[model samples]
Target: MNEETIKNIEDEKFRRLTGVKRSPFEKMLDILREAARLKKAKGGGKNTLILEDRLLRALEYIREYPYLFPYKSKRWGQ
Candidate 1:
């Protein structure tokens, strides 16, 4: 396949995983780069399971309720 076909496939895969159908741009590229960096960091000389557990805990908290921002700021932050 040509480069354009390969990119279309990759973009489709990324969209399926992220649920965001966006055209390829620098921001998306940066995000993919960050993902690779984190993956490599977790894989190299790190306790991967514990890192993943911590990530899951953070995810659970955010999923159950919005986090971080103080209650007062929610009304005014916008």
Candidate 2:
């Protein structure tokens, strides 16, 4: 299946488990944070590399949806 199909499946599973709906961007952030925690805890394992790769992908997604995440930029005088 494609990425959207996989995401939909995960979304349904998350909703059923938590009884709360979350946007895909929120889900990506949640997953990325968990991966980061796990990577640190696992330390030096190959799984850490995998988690890092996933984290980068999630970061790219965030970059694509900058409006979903607000940052203080010097250029913006924030």
**Against the true structure, what is each candidate's TM-score?**
0.27, 0.28
lDDT of 1 by residue, 1-78 (tens): 223433556667735533444444335546656886888877856444433234334444554565554664777875
Model 2 C-alpha lDDT per residue in residues 1-78, reported as the tens digit of each score: 334443556767745533345565467657777877887797864553443345445555655666754544545666
Segments of candidate 1 deviating more than 4 angstroms = 1-49, 67-78
Pairs of residues at least 3 apart in sequence or in different chains that clash in candidate 1: none
> For each candidate, C-alpha RMSD in Å?
9.2, 11.0
lDDT of each: 0.50, 0.55
lDDT of 1 at 49: 45
Worst 10 residues of 2 by lDDT: 47-56
Error of 2 at 56 (Å): 8.5
Q: Could you tell me how far off, in angstroms, the CA of residue 47 lies in candidate 1 after the best superposition?
A: 8.7
lDDT of 1 at 1: 29
